[model samples]
Target: MSGHACGSLRHACAALAVLASIGAGTAAAQQISPAETLLFETEHLARVRVPATLVYAFRKESNVEPGFKDEVRLELAKVNGKLNATLHFLTGVHKQDIPALEEAHGNPVLLGFLEHDIAEMKRLTGGSTAYFRKRIRMALAEGAQVSLQPITYQGKTVQAQAVRIQPYLNDPMHARFEKYLRKTYTFILSEQVPGSLYQLHSSLGKPETVRTGTQPADAPVIDETLTLISVTPKQP
Candidate 1:
């Protein structure tokens, strides 16, 4: 073959290879699902830096309690690869001073409660450890759901995921409490930053009828909301 023809053929082959490479890359990107992408992003964020701090502001409102409002500040940090959180209640009926708590202990009050219950279950079912373990695993699996969504924060649209966790209360007393009580918690977490939370809102209370009338046999009397107003990253 002529040298010119050979050169042209080689160039064509090179172009085809480049196009094939591009096609493969596009296919791989398409194969990544949203959940997988989020997991990858969060995991990447987690490994980025240690001892990072996040700050948030909280607000609480209640319908039954007239003129009821609560303000607080929250700080979340990762220290030595462990998570720590502190809650500072500014003004509220259930106001109190809380010291820094480790994540294992569920730093936030509700999280602490969950951790406590799980620990109690482990202690109680020492003989049937596997059974209890399985129960807890199944409960978590059933209660947890995640979805990719967009949120507006600080005048910018950012990608986020809504994580809903509603573990089953096996304790008879706890079940009784939920029977007549209503509770909701919303946590706003960043998709790009692992362990970074923008907001958390919790609302729990009894119905108006229960509040006005005689208390039911087993009804939890509680009303409150906790919100995260802002998050500021702290230098290591």
Candidate 2:
């Protein structure tokens, strides 16, 4: 459960600096091409069982920010086969991984702030929707603005934006709450290049040091068909 998702947050933050460097370097960008195959470097943090939540942090070759970079932490709650999830994404000036990196390297207060934030996340999502919604609703009601956007992914287009109210919000244990954060960000990609992949070169969890030449065992295995699923582009 903790295998992939748990480490995504850590890896996302670590890769941000490298990604920024690549973005600023023409050579790095040039080496990456639409015909050269695109890779998605991603890490997953946390997994959900019933009312489960999965979080992913990744960087893609194409997006509003090519070499687009950001960390999106998502929490999903499920019940009776219905699923609702919330997403919190940090971008540009509000990016969390980079700032967390700054703190992890030198700022103690930033580290503390991060720890506090994660703890709150865990607390809010630790139980079923019933156990968490009222608290979530109250939090959202506290003046947080909800924004929605249209996104196309997997050949299907849907509104991808921050949503409140999800799977476990109605659990008896969470009745004091009135809302929960539920959102999913969707990506629309077409013409994927083959052989490009985002892989972990090494993990302290394993004996390998971070190396660039070989594939990491934990890298995602994308079936060719799955990659082709639901991809469309607007006519120029």
Question: What does each candidate score in C-alpha RMSD?
Answer: 17.2, 22.5
What's the lDDT of the predicted structure labeled candidate 1?
0.40
Which digits, one per residue and each the tens of the lDDT, describe model 2 over residues 1-236?
12221132333223222222222333233332221111122211112232332233343331112233344443344545443434444456545432322101111111222233334345544643222223332222222333454544435555533222232333344443323222211122222211111111111121121134243555322110011111012111
TM-scores for candidates 1 onward, in order: 0.44, 0.21
Write model 1 residue lDDT over 89-179, tens digit each, in one string.
5545445555565532222433322233334344533423333333333332334456666877666688877654433344233443343
**Candidate 1 clashing pairs, residues 3+ apart or interchain:** 57-229
Compared with the true structure, the alpha-carbon lDDT of candidate 2 equals 0.27
C-alpha positional error of residue 202 in candidate 1 after TM-score superposition, expressed in Å: 3.0
Count of residue pairs whose backbone atoms collide, per candidate = 1, 34
Worst 10 residues of 1 by lDDT: 11-20
